[model samples]
Target chain A: MERCRELVRPALVEAVGRLHPWTGEMAAYALGWADTAGNPDPGGSEGKGVRQALTVLGAEAVGADGRDAVPGAVAVELVHTFSLLHDDIMDADTLRRQRPAVWKAYGTGPAVLAGDALLAQAVTVLAEAPNPRAAAAVRHLCRTLNALVSGQAQDLRFEHRPWNGPGAVGPEQYRSMAEHKTGALLGSAIALGAILGGAPDETVTALERAGRHLGLAFQAVDDILGIWGDPAVTGKPTHGDLRQRKKTYPILTALADSGRAAHELAALLDSPQRIDGEAAGRAAALVEEAGGRAATRDEARRHLDTAHRTLRDVPLTRTAAQELDTLFTHLLDRTW
Target chain B: MERCRELVRPALVEAVGRLHPWTGEMAAYALGWADTAGNPDPGGSEGKGVRQALTVLGAEAVGADGRDAVPGAVAVELVHTFSLLHDDIMDADTLRRQRPAVWKAYGTGPAVLAGDALLAQAVTVLAEAPNPRAAAAVRHLCRTLNALVSGQAQDLRFEHRPWNGPGAVGPEQYRSMAEHKTGALLGSAIALGAILGGAPDETVTALERAGRHLGLAFQAVDDILGIWGDPAVTGKPTHGDLRQRKKTYPILTALADSGRAAHELAALLDSPQRIDGEAAGRAAALVEEAGGRAATRDEARRHLDTAHRTLRDVPLTRTAAQELDTLFTHLLDRTW
Candidate 1:
């Protein structure tokens, strides 16, 4: 992952540098390279670069140098940042990476423009790639964008739906939303890398499938952390998702039950009162009592196992495959 | 132009249909095909289809059928709608085509998502084009998006600059902003069509130059209409730009002068009180008295003449060139 970040960062910087200076500053701030005042933040802790790492590792697994997939890695990273910038505005999130969100630091209009700049730069980078499969990469990226937008729309719509009834969000709906919102980009990351690495179509398909399963597992873990994880470890307030009344995976699963705890949880959530600290704590306990926590853990393990099975079945370079396996295992083991 | 719209509308509808239903409804509303209730509005008056017309004409001028550029036309129209949707949110304009803007009708989040959906669809349409130059089309569109973003950022930044000071926006800066915000997309529309039609690179370049000049002329006319045109014809309130204290071409030109009228106009604009209707009328008269109106007319005429000269110099199909010439002439004559 460190090597992948090293390979992707310079190209990413160059792509961002092409933006207008005003938007460039906002983009840099959003990407964690600069502070709100447009000064470099040397101590800034950046994203883990999981998607870019997958791109590089996918290329390496196809017997290509990691460097060959730099453009795809950078493109995916930029798209990821673009989604985050826009998502923050849509969600009204004021903080990102322990600092002000782009929309909070620079007004909404500038943040919107910055997100747009990053998205445009992502496409331009891929279109300008020297690889023969660049067009295919662009198509894949656009499809991923479509899925991302659909997923976001679904998630937003879910917020307005009833907690329980005919129109309430179901577990299946949650899975589909997660698949579109989170899994599509990860799937595209590996597929794009494989394509750029000159891998066969079937190999790219297999890697994409594995990447998607990994994404689902990752999302399941995040849902768990959003509710029960320690704030110190998660870098978020305890029960943050519950306070927001977000229809996350665990809550949806908990509400899926027809038992006493599930009914009580739903009644509490449906109340007009805000979910303050005390209510959030009780809601967390009720979700656990209704088997939401256990069920979510099982779901995560099941998806992780499927991802591992897909990865093992594919014919990949031994060293890169082993590295990817270790990385996936570490992801599930992560506390943050 | 009507033929171009006939070829492009079906394709545009199909492209927008690919979005999530929620976003698709908002996009339809933004495109003036639907009302606030998501119902089709049979009586809705649509845009003039100038950009798409240029695209189709560009393809025909290169010896290809108008249908050959439908994807390019659809792509540019989608992008144009995307810009309008986002611009309404940024500018906080409540009305579009005498109806509530997308952001005003829907919420900001949905409007933003709809704009994003349209932009993504624009690229997808170009990427999925059967033309061999589809990759080039995508690159050109991405570059145009970059310019559009930069222009919007500059426009927003100009709003904060003093009307008369060292950092105030200058005529050159306004020109650059207008070129990027307006000219870049128009240029790309024609260039993409020509590329798809298999025009030589030099012909594509010449046509792009002509389209850019046409765009500048068009923007100048829009500035004039914003201030002095009849409200009924423009479908806006009287002195809308002056009321908002927007730094348009005429306003910028008027502020550049050192005469007494220019000083008085600056004082009126710099006042803390909002410019109501009466004050807006006064500002308009002052702008005209300071020669802003006449200078802006000269600027528009110069650009239109340059565009005509470029068209005359280029080796184009006689019928298609004559059609484009007619369109350009009509644009300046338009009151709205």
Candidate 2:
């Protein structure tokens, strides 16, 4: 991972820098560089740079040269950054990575433009690759990009009120949103690597599907941590999900259970900001007591199992499979 | 012109309706239909819709099936609407087309989302075209779309303060900004027409260049009217540009020529609101005295000439070329 990180950062910077010549400053800010003043401010500043790493790792795992994957690395990172910029604006959270969000910092006018530049450049840069295969990647990327935005719109709509009319968000609905928001991009990341490598179509599909499963597990874990993770570790406020009243899987499970704990959770949700420290602690305990936490864990584990199975079944070399295995397992096994 | 408007309005509405699966409220609002609350409170509101008409006309000029250009028409209109939504927000303009702007009516968040949705659906709908040609349209439209945003950024940046520094914004900078702000999409409108009509590359290039020039002429005439036209005639405020203090070509030209009038003009520009109606009238007279309006007209005429030249060069029936010539001439010939 460290080796991959070192290889991809400069390229990520180059790609983002080359993105919007007019709006490039906003793109730079998207990468956690500055606040348009060129001041070195840290606000969880650097992205995990995980998407670029995913591209390179996907390439290496498929027995393709890492150098061949550079374009794909740049492409994936551009999509990822654009998604973050736009989503931050749509969510209206005002803070991203603990910094004033782009929309908040420069105002929504420029933040949206900055995000627009990223998406436009992603296609432009991909078109630069002299491979006919690049067209397929571009096509798939556009579809995924559209899905990402659609999912976000749907998710934002969910926040306006209790969706499905007074019931917890169902697990299937959670999966659908996760698929569009997180898994679609992840699948595109893996698919990009395979197509750039000239891997067979079947293997490409498997890797993409594996990525989807991994993304689902990743988000499920994220949801669990959103409610219960320590701020010291998560860098997010305690009960941040409760604060937003986000309908993550665990909370949904608790709400749908229709028991004493469920009733208490509903009461907490009805009164915005009513979930105080003790109330939050009690709510978390009730959620776990009502099997919500366990249910979420089981769903995540199921997806992780599917990802591993797909990785094994994908018709790639043993080494390729092993690299993917390493990445997915580590993603699922994160403790904080 | 009535026939063109008839062809464009319903088609534009239907295309935008396919975008978010939501009701046609935003599109309707933009189209000057129902109000923000979905009431049928419409008597006035309509943009030039010139971009959409151009797409259809460009296709017709090729003697190709006009329906083939529908995706391009929809895509360009949506991109144009997105720009209007964001532009109104950035400009802090309260109204558009004698009605509330999208941001004003829908609130900032939904207006932004609506714009984002429009843009996303623009790409998605283009991608959905039944041929690879539609994909190419997507490719060109995305680039055009980016440039549009960049242009808006430049326009917004310039709005923050005066361009009191060096260089005559000249024909070149104005041309560049106009091309990005409006021309590229018009060019896309034409090129996509040629593509959808299966016109050859040379013809497409000619159409595109023609569209660029037409766009410049369009904006120049707009800038001219923004200041000089009667409010009753133009259906906008007289000296609107002066009120906006827009550093358009005429103003820039006036500013570039040094004199007492130029100094007074600059003073009025520095504090546009402080300038009385008499002072504003004096400023416009001084701008004319400084050869501002004449220089702008000359530039507009130059572009119109180039646009006609490109139209003549393209391999088409003389009648089709003449039709385009008439359209360009009418656009440049707008009185108010």
Candidate 3:
């Protein structure tokens, strides 16, 4: 993972720097490369670079050199950051990676433009690829972008749905959102690697399927951690999604369950009062009591199993396949 | 113009409808294709498809069928609307085409996402072009997008600069902003048509140059009209830009000129009081007295001449070149 991050970081930096200086500064700040003053911030942390690693891993899985997928990786990461910049504003998240979010630091206008520039840069980078596969890469990336935006729109609307009314969010709706919001990019990342590596269409489709399953599992785990993980490890408050009344998988699962705990959890969420820490804790306990936590964990495990099963049929070398197996297992096992 | 709008409107509708339903609805509203309830609003006027017409005209100038450039035309128009959606938000303008802006009708979140989806869709539309020229089209459009974003960033930053401070806006800076903000897309519109039509590199370059001059003239005329245009025809309040203290071409030009009226206008703008109707009227008079209005009009004519001169050397057929000349002249002569 570290090696992949190192591989993709320079290209990402140079790609962002190609934007207009004003937007470039904001992009650099959002990407954790430089501070607001345009100076490199060595202490700032870039996130796990999971998407780029997956691109490389997907290429390697197709028996192609991973370096061939660097453009694809860079494009995926840019799109991811683009979404992050805009999502942070939509969600009113004031901090990212323990620093002021781009919108908070530079004001909403610049942050929005930075996101726009980054997204345009993503397509530009792919179009500049020195191969015929560039066209296919662009097409796939655009589809992914459409899905990401759609998912985000749906997620925003979901927030306003009645807590327990007929139009309330359900596990199915949450899973659909997760698929569009999270799965689209991951699937695109894997498919990009395969297409860029000159893999067959069948192989690209299979890789995309595996990526979708992996994304579902990844998001499910993230939802669980949002409510249950340690703040120190998760970088989010315990029951954070619950306190905010986010219709995450666990909360929706609990809402759907037919039991006293489910009713109580719904009542707590539907209340007009803000959920303070104590109420958040009680809400978490109610979710657990309604079997929501276990259900979410089981759902994640099911998706992980599907990913493994799908990969088993892929024609990867033994070494590459084993690496993927280990990586998937490790990812689902992380406490954060 | 009506014939061209008829030609492009269906495809534009189809293109936006391809987005997710929610974003599609917002996009439709933003584009004036539909109302808030997703019904076609007959009274809602779609802006003249000027960019698309330029694109088709560009293709015809290169001896290609105008229909051949529809995809490119669609891409350019999508990008134009995409910038409009975001710019309306940044400018905090509640109205567009005499209707409430997208961000005003729908909340900012959906408006932003709709803009994003439209941009991605623009790229996707280009990538789907059957010809291999699609890649070049995407690249040019991306460059145009970068310029548009940069221009917008500059425009936003210009708003906060002191009227006569060290960082105050000047004519050159304002012209650069106009070139990027308005010129880039127009230039891209022509270039995309040429590229899509399989025009030689030289032809594409000439068309781009012509487009840039036209853009500069377009914006300069827009600035002049903003203050002096008849409200009954222009559909904007008298001195609307002045009321908002927008550093438009005329204002910036007047600021840079050395004269008594220039200093007085600067002081009036620098004052803490808002420019209401009386002050806006006074400011307009002072700007004219400072030679700002005349200068802006002269600048527009100069760029119009440049565009005509550049087109004179291009290899377009007599009919097509004459068509472009008449169109450019007609456009610059419009009162509203």
Best candidate according to DockQ: 1
Quick one: ranking by DockQ, best first?
1, 3, 2
The alpha-carbon lDDT assigned to residue A157 of candidate 1 equals 95
- Residue A308 deviation, candidate 3, in Å? 2.4
TM-score of each model's chain B:
0.98, 0.91, 0.97
TM-scores of the candidates are 0.98, 0.91, 0.96
Model 2 ranges off by over 4 Å: A1-11, A19-22, A39-44, A59-68, A163-168, A199-201, A272-274, B1-18, B23-28, B31-48, B60-63, B132-136, B161-172, B233-235, B272-279
Q: Tens digits of per-residue lDDT for model 2 on A124-172?
A: 6765666667767666776776677667766766676572354446767
- Model 2 C-alpha lDDT versus the unseen true structure: 0.75
TM-score of chain A of 1: 0.98
Per-candidate clashes come to 0, 1, 0
User: DockQ (Cα-based) per candidate?
Assistant: 0.83, 0.43, 0.77
> What is candidate 2's lDDT per residue for B263-315, written digit by digit as tens?
77777776637555777688789888877899889878888899988888777
Q: Per-prediction fnat values? A: 0.75, 0.32, 0.70
TM-scores of the first chain across all predictions? 0.98, 0.92, 0.97
Q: By the DockQ metric, which is better: model 2 or model 3?
A: 3
lDDT of 1 by residue, B94-124 (tens): 8888888888888887888888889999999
What is the CAPRI rating of model 1's predicted complex? high
